[model samples]
Target: MIMVNRFSRLIGTLIDRAAALQHIASQCILCAAPGQKGLDLCLPCQLDLPALTQCCQQCALPLFDHKAYCGQCLLSTPAYQRVEAPWLYQPPIAQLISRFKYSRQYSIGKVLSNIAARRYASAYIDQKLPDLIVPIPLHWSRQTIRGFNQSEHLARYYSHHFNIPMKRFLKRCRPTAAQQMLTADQRRSNMKGAFQMCGDVAGKLVAVVDDVMTTGTTVSEASQCLLKAGATEVHIWCLARTE
Candidate 1:
């Protein structure tokens, strides 16, 4: 029995290594050039990604000036303290995200998660890191249909990279219509009471991880739930933000 277990573990490690080597040799997903530096993205294409050059410091929305908050945020502040998104949701980045979320492209998801993790580290190197990372949960039905939650996957990457703990502390108690199809007011209405706290977060700084931030309604609702559960602060981290 011991011998068999050892052989099985060895086989699993070999398989993982082989897969990693194959991925390193694969062609670039964007330009179809040969792989370079063990990544699917070539150097030029990687540089050309739709980075969020200028954004409101509070909400991470694209901004024309160096304002801390956008006009809407000034009117009414969001529950979360700040949002950090590395890219604007547009063009090739949007297409890649769609493939990762809807098309079951796990490789693309891994690439995106890696990029987001690097960006998060650089952005917060001089600042206070969150005590815990919480992924924006999906309803059980949605999770069953999708096989996995993209937000959870991103959270795992951040957890591994930053050595921070992650918890599925938020639960989606009710499933609502897709936020993309609704107006801002409708989105807010749809998300009301949609999230519930599954674990105590009292006096802790938590970061909510999600794939994208559109109107910020979903994260706001989730943040409100966390705060109501006694969390001291909540921050939003996402791959992209739609302007």
Candidate 2:
């Protein structure tokens, strides 16, 4: 027992040091420019990155000037209640998300998720921190291929502020096709039945975390699994949503 305890302490110290080095409280992910206190992007990058203003509250699509719901959202309501995203899907932000997802730039996700959990959080969002944060699960095959689920890693940082539990609530029963490579219509069909709830979500509000929402297909499919498992409602929190 003594030997194991000593080894664990040593490992913990090393981890602490490593994470401290990896974390940047105020630095732009796009450019290595110094940022103001608590600012994610430096002045240049901050001003340059496109902000998605005039977005729909429920669906989170870009509105022209003074519109609420996008045309499609009015025609159809999404499964989730409200979606909050900070920025539009553009150059620098796009690159950041790609690295976090494909290139294994986990540190970027850590920072962005922290921001999402804090900035994107509302009174209801704060209230519904949920019994747990369920990351939209990736198929085992994809996990095997990519080595990690981007949403799960992103949620870890955000869950810190929300003061609620975060865990792997859903599991991929099969390896579905990648959404990136598919057409918009095909993407919807591919994600159908992609997720399964591994735990009871009944009477529980779940915060589903993801990096981006383009078609809202991926998170919706995951919500179906959670609701099927008896979840009360599913809410999505993402770093960016393209209009």
Candidate 3:
């Protein structure tokens, strides 16, 4: 029986490796062209991705000028110190995100995560890296329906690539209406007191990871919760930002 179990485990491992290689040998998700080199996207499609060239350092909204803060940030500051979103929420990228988030197309998600990870590594090479990465949590009910949290998957990729620890330090205490359906004020009100700390973050610098940032209310509320739980500082990291 012991030998049989060992043989089964080895077979399973080999099967998994073969599946991974097959996936890497597949074509691009966008253009259907070959030579992806392990990515689900082709080099041309990757280069054509809409990047956030001029954005506010605080909120990551696209800016017309070379300003650190946008007009909105000047009026009011967010709880998180800064946001780093490498791409704009635009076509092809938007479609990829939708497929990843709603349809559980994990290959698309992996492609997006790889781009974001590379951008992060280059941008933060000389800067202070966060001690921990905390993904924005979904309520249990929503997670049960979705089968996975897109944010957590993206965070996991970053953790693996950057050698940083990813922790589920916060929990969603209750379900809230989708942020896209609500007005900015309504979104802020809906997220209030929605998160509770799951672990101690005392004096630790944290980077909150998410797939997208729209009104910024969700991350703001989450940052406040982490700060209340004794986190020294909070930074926002997302794949895309909407203007």
Each model's total of backbone clashes: 0, 1, 0
TM-score of decoy 2: 0.81
Model 2 agreement with the true structure over 1-243: per-residue lDDT tens digits: 999999999999998877665455556777777654555557677667677677897888877778877778789888888787888998778888998899997667765676566566653654545777878877777888899989888777767776778889898888887677789789988988778777878899888988899889898888888888888888888889886
For candidate 2, the C-alpha RMSD (Å) to the true structure equals 6.4
Of 2 and 3, which scores higher on lDDT?
Answer: 3
lDDT of 1 at 162: 90
lDDT of 3 by residue, 1-243 (tens): 999999999999999999788766877889888636567777888889899989988899998788878988999888899888989999977898999999999989888898899898888899998999999999999999999999999999999998999999999999999989998889989999999999989999999999999989999999999999999999999999998
Clashing pairs in 2: 202-230
TM-score computed on alpha carbons, candidate 3: 0.89
lDDT of every model, 2 decimals: 0.90, 0.79, 0.91
Deviation (Å) of 93 in candidate 1? 0.6
lDDT against true structure, model 1: 0.90
Better of 2 and 3 by TM-score: 3
Q: Return the TM-score for each candidate structure.
A: 0.89, 0.81, 0.89
> How many Å off is the CA of 222 in candidate 3?
0.5
TM-score order, best first, reads: 3, 1, 2
Q: Where does candidate 1 have its weakest 10-residue lDDT segment? A: 34-43
| Stronger candidate by TM-score (1 vs 2) | 1
Error of 2 at 102 (Å): 1.6
